[model samples]
Target: MRFSSTVAFPLAANLLPPLASAIRISPAPNGALLLRDSYDYIVVGAGIGGLVVANRLTEDPSVSVLVIEAGDLDDRGEDVSIPGSVGFEDPRRYEVKLTMTEQEFLDNKTRTVSQGKAVGGGTIVNGLVWTRGSTANFDAWERLGNPGWGWSGLLPYFRKSETYSTRDHDISACKIPVPVHPVNGKHGDQGPVEVGYPNYYYNQSDNFLDGVQQLGIPVNEDPNSGNATGATVVPSSMTQKNQSRSDARTAYLDPALGRDNLHLVTNHTVTHILHNSSGNAIASRDTPIVNVTGVEFASNVTGTMMNVTCDKEVILAAGAILSPVLLQISGIGPAQHLKDLGVNVAVDLPGVGSNFQDHPTLQPVYKYTAPDVFSVQDIVGATRDAVREEYLANRTGPWTTPMVNAVAFPALSWVTDNFRELLDEAVNTTSNLPSSYDSTLRAGYAAQKNETLCFLSRTDTPTYELMSTSWGQLAVSAMQPFSRGTVLARSSSIFDNTQPIVDPRYCSNSIDCKLLLLGIKFNDHLIATSPMAALMPVPPPGFGTADARNETSLDETMRAMITTGFHFSGTTSMLPQNLGGVVDPSLRVYGTANLRVVDAGVIPLLPGAHTQATVYAIAEKAADIIKAGSSDAFPGAKS
Candidate 1:
């Protein structure tokens, strides 16, 4: 049922257009051609979601699919492809170089929020850990008016998106209690995306796991299964040979290069969606849900404006920040905001850019002063050169293994004492949110708070995610944060180079601050355990651990230390319109006929796991939904 094979594309495309014009080609068959043309579907943003949807929809040779990517191919060289290049930061790879408005809680400091600008999106420059959330996470989607979006409904598509592989040798030989499923047939084997465990495991990785076991957390062999609790060795989207990154470019796009039915236009920024007149027909109470005719775009290099039409639909997969920005500029946002910005209202959909959620993380670096292990700094001069030579020769060395190899998911009760009472107090108070929110948004936040309490009560699901990365750092993140922020266009024009204002509202919610502190306490306990204590861990050699004896000190230290987990969602939520949602169960924008959002933005809630795994599954399911509704989609498609 998977369309991962490139062979299927040509066989199917033979029934319609010639091979040359099947996908994307410059210097048209004729002398000249206008960039503004029509296609059955025009997908904006070439992220994983957009790529997956385009690949599946293009299975129909009769139906043309065009993917317009704002960023160029990630030709960033070795820094992007190699594993050890993680700690290095490169600003050119990101599309949205945003800084949040000074936070009221985080010492009034503005934190930078970046998004991937490459053709493969964040996959090109993200930590490639692969894991899924608990069953309760997806079931919550069903509870929020999105029927058939629970774990059971989505697992099939999860398996459909990637080819899962395990290590050849017994991973148990490491003597670490970490359970690993070597070759489970339940996982995908023939999909384009490669999902596998690392071939090389660090010496300290086993020690880290042992430390977690000493802390009384169970060891899970596989977190990909529904109930994701306990410590486990995480799988990643990596190649089996070189153990290098396997991103959206390698997954869905490269295979279908010869597909003339699929067109990829790179280095073009999508400015705004073009809509047709609704005439006298009212879409709702006082708004018009006008049909999206096309999208206006401009070349990144030349800055030449262009227009492209769609016969069927315009899909927006422009991530959380940009997607909402696009909607706002196109007049499908808050009526008052649009009016203030001098844009004609398409729909007074109040929920276009509200409910922004992310995994706010705090990384506490510990100095590894133990013997028999080498940190990134230990391999200096000659040793570093030798290691680099070995890696370049075979692509299998210390550099081949990513710093993030293992993770632990701990329940709140396991991490903190009297967690229930602490949670109840947090839930009862309205200080978790700003008091001036609109009535609909406030109701949405209230519903989210209830759902979060329900999540906290589940022992099988963990509220906090803990990980040890780069040999000397402990990453403690509040996986299910109660804080909801906003993404707003800096100006009325979509052409404005100024990035959208992204406010994650990190630690703004009292519950979120409490959870983060609990996570920090949990990490401290882990390092202080017998096995880890013998390692003689210090605070990055110079800096000392926060003296969080009191609430004020803890709050102040956390404000200075907090950063993003890079998992942003819920800007364009999937709840019903009445609940301040932008998209419906089918991912279609509430009031638009031919516009749908198929990115992390539509995720109404943040799952306990990383956003990578769930996003691929969501995209796969979205493709199925679009295919079932299309007359010319593949055969034997589910409706």
Candidate 2:
């Protein structure tokens, strides 16, 4: 079946109601204008975190907030708004290219790391999963010296940004059966963001859930509930009836367009945060005075430089990958690395770009007996036409299906236990530090020691702290890895075409590798299980073996297939200044008083679920913290 590539449709050109008056952009005199000449707050990157922060902070009419985005806003064109038409939309049409770097990972040379460079950031390009970190995961944060970050503390904000679709009770019941805990707060009825199950569903999803259950995994009606350790059909971060993608723009920017206090600038690349030399005392301190004087950026649209001063604060919400790079570019990373790139160090915070983490995933494809599963051929043929017909006529069909509608979470007890033991042994072996060593040898030793220690420390850590199991395998990840990686400057000149260093340093720790191995094994087991058995061609050909345990030798092949789960986190981590953290609990950067990082980068640790809901909750709580002069009310605030 071939789908039609062209279909005429009506568009609501006036979807966005005009504000009191449209703010026209005057051409730059010669270069772009800096924040010093513009607004009170400047938010860099328009991802979920940035949008939320920008939306909330701009609520005060007295304070004008400027959001500089690297990408263009969604056109709400047919391809972007129609379900299943995502592929038809040119990926480049929605992309704003950031520079790329040639880096090695797991022996693979030259990997390109791309980030969403457009108005909505990654939210526009992502799969739109709406999972939140577990309650246990949040509570663990409080235990880890960051108070007020637990599930109870963050529930209000979760509810605040969500307007869940109450329409499709039947579909919602089957997909997400778990009832919301009243104590956790109800879904926000008046929130700007919309959350609900996709407007359509495929039969295979239900069968997939049943297959995992047959393999001894329990079926979880709600993956968002604190416990995400079983097979479940989860909800997408999308609106219901219209099937329009619920990106950051749809959720935050659309509603905020008419607000007088909010200003969004597209095609602007923030270069650095301007500091006030007059306030040397605050500037020298670890907790930098939050008083950010200005921000400098390059106007991508005009090829000119600009500076904008902030009267209140400068917030960096550039996602896990770019946020750290932005900091390094601004001279806030390790002094040595900054000097190597010939960039002056504004702050000597070693942890500024450290602790990079993401849920690395691998796709093990199977040939199902059923004919309905989508493939590249189906996307181009008659099947596509039928699906498109149904979609345009009734708003139902394959267009509504996410890449994976149902997911399984399996606990591999054996792998978990072995990993714990291995980590413990490694830790015990490296307990005492050496007094001295050759510089070269010392560097090698330091790298090895860091990896081993992170693994060991992570294993012994409580389940809530880690999330997921230490088992032999788990198909799904709720694993909160403790290993830290770094992001540094690759070059001094942005115009010189230098790519920012993005070392996810994935599985640098042996324990992380082991956990990922277990995850694959679990995936194999679930596929082999009876209920799901019909969907599989055993061994999954190249990716797996008949004997899951013996297939451990295929670790290299598995790693090659692994890509990010889109859960990038922990860069610009929030810890006390003395502990090498960039931000305090108040989400304020060290040595900068009025500047704060209110996004996932401020997340000190990875949570056990998708970051969307948690990011929202964090923004909600941050709004309150920023509103109240005292930071003590929030988690991770310094005493």
Candidate 3:
């Protein structure tokens, strides 16, 4: 049955001792506090995943959940709550930047990879796009042996965690729609999470959608229905009337914050997962013992190390990059890599830090000769002051805008069936399969064979995969990318000067490069289309004839301008241990039982849309599995 409201489990009171004595809670030590000396569940990194898991698990009174957030909660006024304040260039919402160095990807020079280290994780400082991948994509995962990961299996959780706010008349007047799936009974009605259309929109947004439609792309009513193959104006995680942005903290934490069983510790960093010498049976054991529990954290202000312990499980929700690094530091990654840095290997799971993937985006901006829609600069000065006054007075203004007002999915023709056949043949012929080919590869090969032989009827066409085509002078990104990358820690020490290496290997695969280039070309084609061209009389800056020429080769230009889509996945990938996967289908690391990863890091492959909604779904499903004794909840026979 449905456990949405009837599940009235109380949190374990014995787990939380006071913040004063349980652990040291001091701001002088970077304003970090030890709210609980021991908890049944110690979730590391207060990102979307951690917050969801903690919030869900705490519903049970018997389970004491402690969420240690490295960064402080949003105290910078209501600027973060504003709707129009979203964009890559917006600096008011994001203050603390957790920087990483990626030398292998960007011109082989160290580049800073910044992520929000605060309460809501990237949700507080992200595009706030609410989209999901294609059902076909998830079906492919199940076909590859991950049984429960299929779209059908996961759709329930997606609906359960969502509370769609679609009744606002202003949104309808703006032409923004919330398309719901026919079989959406599983969705919550009065849930705390708010999902709705943003109130404000650029006039060009409508023109942009019409332009793409004229260029042969169909308009989709609901992009989140698992078939993201058309252009449409998708919704965001925001309030309907006020138009204020709703972050993960607002959706998951704020409603449940008053629960005494749920304890939140800010300014605390989790260094590693503590394990006992039970050796390797740790994962399967029902009662795993902790030798001596402790967490390694530093002051957000001064960057100093602090150690704290947990009475039970240490859950790692440190996103795709930091999660794997934390595992390696805890001696759970490649045995050879850990030995090189003088750290004792706890678990010899070679896949702990392998199978990394990310969506690399290239935006070819078009300069609008006409006074384009309101630009970020337009809202500054007196406009900014007025918006600030409005926000302070009523919590509404341009400051509440999400990064992108609209998003659409378009398919690229290059990475179609023919391309897959060629890649499959090449992979089969290559004797050296990088020693990383495990179940995922075998499953991919098997799926390829079936596709080639039967010519399966699938909605997601490689020739036209999912691309986030939208209005404005820009397109969000292509939903699914064939390119694969990796995230590696430079040293075992959590405090190592070296940054965690992230090589997106963007456009490294010819198919991915072609898809990106095609997407850019298609976007340009849409702008030139009759219906849209009439409205968008002028294009945004960076779109010109010289750049759009057929002979110009948009591939080169895309490679030069492409940036990380920020949808990082597959680092601590979920696959069979033998297949170079760190976590199993249940999301528990192969060699460790008491420890588990509940974040984007375990995503076997990138979803076809934005990761925020998918991440929330993953966390919701993970909580269910964890609550249902872990064995009978997920794919594969439970360990």
Candidate 4:
């Protein structure tokens, strides 16, 4: 089946009535006009986190907020809104040119890393899966010295950010059968973001669910209810009526656009964070720590520079990559590395771009030969007229769904017989630490290893996630990998347009490799088992060529095929300063008084789920934290 690189469907233009009427946006002003313009708050990026903080902080009519986004407003265009479309390929819609450095473990190959350059950020180009990590995942954050960040503490914000809508039509309409639970989940119904299921379900969904159950994995009542183990059909961030993609723009930014206090500056890239300094502007260890004052930005189109000051605070929500890069170039990274780049070191924090983590994923395809079953191939491979008819007649069709409807999170025990031995090796082995790792990074990894080993027996603390799509693909990923990577600025110039050196160091740790191998072996077993085998499954056209019957054969395929999950985080981790943490528990930088990083960058560790939902919850909680003046105002806030 061949998919078009560009589909001509402007789904965002058809946002349901009330949501469209709420926005009041305008283009950014000229860079020359703002020499010393100031506001109550300055948000660096207009992604999900930045937008959420901007909207909430502007709630008080007196406080003025400015959001400077590198990309323009994507008005639900064809690439941004349509599912399974090549939105990530559109340079205007996403940062398609971003490439990571050659990973040493993945056969020294450079991986293409796609980040949303548009206003909505990654939410504009992702698969639209709305899922939260396991309870153990969040609890690990609090255990790592971040107070009030466990599952229970963040649940309210999760509920507050979403407006749940049940699927109105019957599942039988899509020729798929599964037990329905309309109210078993704990989701909000009054928030701005829409959460619901697609009108169409692939016929393979039931087979995938049954295959996992046959493996002794229990069915989860609700994947979002703190426990994400078992086979489940996860909901997505989309509207129920036409299944329009509900991104940060529709949920958080649009609703707050009418506020007179909020100002959005599109097509502006934040170059560096400005701090109070003197004498040749050379920052060193002896330099006294001062509060962040403002930021300098460059016009995306014309390259003109401008400075915008803030009276209260400067929030960095430029996501995992840019957020850390901003700090590094702004003289807030490792002292030695900064000096090499000719950047003044404002704070000699070694953890600015360290502790980088991401999910290493691979596709294990299985060709199911069932005449009665309908696959995504039948949709995308169909005549253009047929797809167009279904879409134009009713917005809910194969063209609207991203084909990733069902997902499974399986524990190590469910996959391998020697779970105990694997856990011991994973927890005890510290030699896997890369040569670049310093004493501080090693200590941080030690803490993470201990916490992960503590949850070895818990089924909910899954080490890997298996997401099934209608395209005969099993997307397997090691969720809570111990392997750490680093993202550093190659040059001092932020606009040198030089891609940062992103080395995920996939499979660097033996335990991570072992766990990923287990996940691949589990998929092989599931496909060869009863319910799935009934469909006469065969190896996907080109993949699984070598026999996947054993770990040895599968390990080779895993190494050659493993790719980035696009869930980059942990660069600017939120932990204690002594534990190699850049940001404190309050989401504040340790040295700066009024600077905070409220994006995926602050996630101390990678969770066992997709990053979209957790990013929203983090923003919601950040709003309340910023409003109350301190993290201690919250119930779970640590001293």
Candidate 5:
């Protein structure tokens, strides 16, 4: 049942024409030749989701898969391949900066949201911490109309995505009650993505987990099995032999690249999904779903417009922001918005770009006055040079691990005293919107609010992620935020560098601010604990002081610390269309046939843990649905 191997299925590719798949990187209009005139599937955006889906769909020789990546294939240089070079490299090489200016909230401050723009997507530039959310986090997906999307349903695919390596974790090194949890499901024997521990983690990482235990919060040893609610030593998506980052580049795309049935075009921006109601295999005959014909793209550098057709489907894996932007510009969005852009509306679907959700993070820096354990704070000058030399010579050392090692997930009851009070306000976050808010969106939020209430009432739910990263910083992101934002196209020209109006609307809801303030409160308690106080001796300036840091002072620090966690989702939600969802349980867009979204965008709710692991699983399951030829593979998907 596992299909991660690169060996294509032995089937006749009679439907696919002869292709010159050996395409060298070239300038346009010559680059258009890299793409065949037609393909069975044209996948937009080569992010983690796109890469996984493309790899699986092409396993059948009868299918021709074309992956159009807006960013070029990574050089696989140490800057990207090494785990420690995360913040050191120029991000523009791997990420796109979607600038948001003068927000309606957060005192009218501006922020820039960055997403993976390369062939491997964010996995190339992201923190290599490998973790999954609670079982309840995914079970909520099933409750939200997606049946086969719960924890039990997706665990097999989660197992199908990685090969985990055993580690002799030094329990003595960790001055804690529990050392390690048993790996549940005993999964990970056959997958391309490598999941293992770093050889050169900071000595204080174990102590951080010990501090959480001292705080009365249970440390979850292996939440990857199911429930995730405590602090644990986070593993990395790193190679077992070299300890280099094992991202979408090294894992899925590279091994599958040599196959003749698969073709990938880089540095081309997909502008629109071309359609005229002609070809669609999965469009329901009873509905008014329009047939998706092809995609219109342009060279990122030369702006040479080109088009290619697809025989079956046009899959949108362009992440939360651009995927919806592509739909709106392609006339498959809100009728009024499309009319404003002077584009004819393909589908009058109003939920194309609404319900934008993200893990809004607030990072407050604390000076490590404790005996210089040589963490990210002191990775400079001679130490940096010495580590670089050791890594280059021996291929192991401080360079093998990113600054983010162990993260603590705490429930609201453990972090704050006003759990009941906060839960009441949290449940109403998505309700009672202004007149401008769509009625269907309001209904969707109402349903989502019920899920939020469910998470808050449970002891297994970790409402906040207390993470310590580089430069003596304590960052916290609300595991499940209630605020809803938008990603509307300013104009119908994303291919020409028209930045979509990107706004997560951080702190638009009152509960979101409360969650962040509670995080600040938790940081104060964390550093005060005996074990953590030894590692992070100093807290942020005068802050983290119970009485010294009141509402106004903490609010000021929060305003300065708040930033997007980069785990964006819910723009193309997978809920019933009546509930203001863009995609159904089948992941197909509301009014478009053969146009499915398989990125974090379709995840209606943000999981309590990092999105990296869950996104891979999403793509894995998505490939199954596509291979089964629609929702027929999924029970109860007939809805």
Candidate 6:
């Protein structure tokens, strides 16, 4: 499997429909008919991670696997299947939006965080961009405490998750040349997920590149080739057969549903992970360590709590936001926080909900004065009706990709001339962690800060990203955010009727804002340059000015426009237990046997890339670990 990198590459010419999903495993309203009393393994949250694990574990046929999901199967046709039908499709049909706790840094404004509400998880609604940030991003995971979790160690599994395609296909239906990435050996050929270039490349790709190259930033050509510091065209996870969205369900789960060994129960939220008790409803304090035995779930339709047993293990693939909340509610989080929430402490892991990180984006939309060029802006604005009709009728055109066709990943040095000063200020500040953080969390933040500082000083690793959409909108995200936050549970019971307090603490570190503002400065210059100047003639508001904006004005813009790239991770980090880590290198919950987290939550650090592709890779690697009996395979395992 290969993930191509791009800052702002075009998507056109290489297109196909979708693989036949005639045999989908519909969501079982109740597990009574589909589930067993005790399966070899129980996977919670039938999202990317759980589905991959279930499909692989059941391959033995000798063992049975059960999957529990909180949402129903995706039934929204185009919204769930189309490649670039993100904002244009039914927005919230398959997603559950959580109102995050008011961000103190963002002027006490609460943002809505939307997660996939269906069985397929976030894959059901995320942007179809598939990429891995850089080699430094994954290598940092190994530096945090995990062995064989680095870039080289994980690339094989990344290759094992997707079938990368580079061959040209018919593009005449839409009357365009097929756009494709180079077929390097770094990609895979026979995998579940489909990885390939879209069928329509935006004409402005070369123009943007020319304008950027004038600034001395070289083209990376491939963002996933261990270097993600330049502009390039990225690949999307779409089926080569029909040019439809290829997600966890369409790629991995749908094809394996006929196997009797695998069972899935959707529309059921796993409230708590049942464990070996000290003969009590809540395990006694004396028995701090326990093994998971089963799970207690509440039905979405009935709201009734039910239990199912598992003979081997319980894997949490609920995602970064929910996984840590699950651990806290399951008596396995920070002991003090659990006690305050009236929950018994099974494992006093302080890191269960700490180290929360995400890519904080600043979305600034710029309207073009004219739509004369060959960019998505030109195609969508000039011939909107005709292009949409062509895409829906023939499955080709600019509609196959989201409006955002190109991206720019520049190191701090390229972003701003004051890099040394920012690094110095960051290094001298000592701590950028949240106030409520525990000592162990501070230790972890310190380690992460050092890694971030290293990334900031480097010229090849991108610390910020700049992307442009078809609508003349520009979005930038701080790639390696220094600030850390927490995901605190509201109560011990899942029936609390409240979402967890997800405080990403965006822009808490002053340095993050500086980086984003610098990114804006870089984009401002590029838009005014020769080739891009003709495409998008107007300068963005509060940008592209001869005079630099003041700190106060920039701060106001950041506070008003800040949002997420939806690339969340690091709540239940994989690191040393003593360093505020929830899961060990083997992805197991510390101090608990037979319980593991196989999702984005365990990623110790947020990767510079979109999370979907990396999540697929992590899930693939985790399946291998679970099947090998983690304890015996990785002796340095913390759990």
In terms of TM-score, which candidate is strongest? 4
Model 6: how far is 18 from its true place, Å?
12
lDDT of 6: 0.74
Compared with the true structure, model 2 gives a TM-score of 0.82
List candidate 2 stretches off by more than 4 Å. Answer: 1-36, 86-89, 96-105, 166-186, 278-291, 370-379, 412-478, 496-498, 536-540, 547-552, 635-639
lDDT of 6 by residue, 1-639 (tens): 111122121233333233223322343675344446788898998889998998888889898888887777766375466665655545446667788888887778898867777767888777778888788988988898788888888888778888887535554533212223553755777889997666665656656666777787777766777788877667778876566788888677778756788877776788899986442222222233687899998775357677889888899998888888888888888778888998877767788888988888887765555556554434444386687667777777776765554677878888677889988987886456776677878888888888888888887788877776655666788888887778888888765634778888887887777777787777778887787777755655555464346756766766767887788888889878667888877788777767899988988988787888898888888888887884436322111
| Backbone collisions counted per model | 6, 50, 33, 1, 0, 24
Ten-residue region with minimum lDDT total, candidate 5: 1-10
True lDDT of residue 13, candidate 2: 50
lDDT tens digits by residue: candidate 5, 312-401: 999999888888888888887777888889877777777778888888887677767666566754667788778877776766777777
Q: Rate the local accuracy (lDDT) of all candidates.
A: 0.75, 0.59, 0.61, 0.76, 0.75, 0.74
Model 6 residue runs over 4 Å out of place are 1-34, 167-183, 278-288, 373-385, 539-541, 544-547, 632-639
> Which consecutive 10 residues in model 1 have the weakest lDDT in total?
1-10
Residue by residue across 450-489, what tens digits does model 2's lDDT show? Answer: 4334423442222211111101112344254534455666
Candidates' TM-scores? 0.90, 0.82, 0.82, 0.91, 0.91, 0.90
- Tens digits of lDDT, candidate 4, 225-288: 8878778887888877766678898788877757878888777788889998431232222233
What candidate 1 gets wrong by more than 4 Å, as runs, is: 1-36, 93-96, 170-177, 182-186, 278-288, 300-302, 431-436, 540-546, 630-639
Candidate 3, residues 565-625, lDDT tens digits: the string is 7778877877655445666666776666567788888877666677888888788778887
Listed per candidate, the RMSD to the true structure in angstroms reads: 6.4, 6.2, 7.8, 3.6, 7.0, 5.3
Q: How many angstroms is residue 164 displaced in model 3 relative to the true structure, after the best TM-score fit?
A: 0.4
Q: Is candidate 1 or candidate 3 better by lDDT?
A: 1
Q: What ordering of candidates by lDDT runs from best to worst?
A: 4, 5, 1, 6, 3, 2
The TM-score that candidate 5 achieves is 0.91
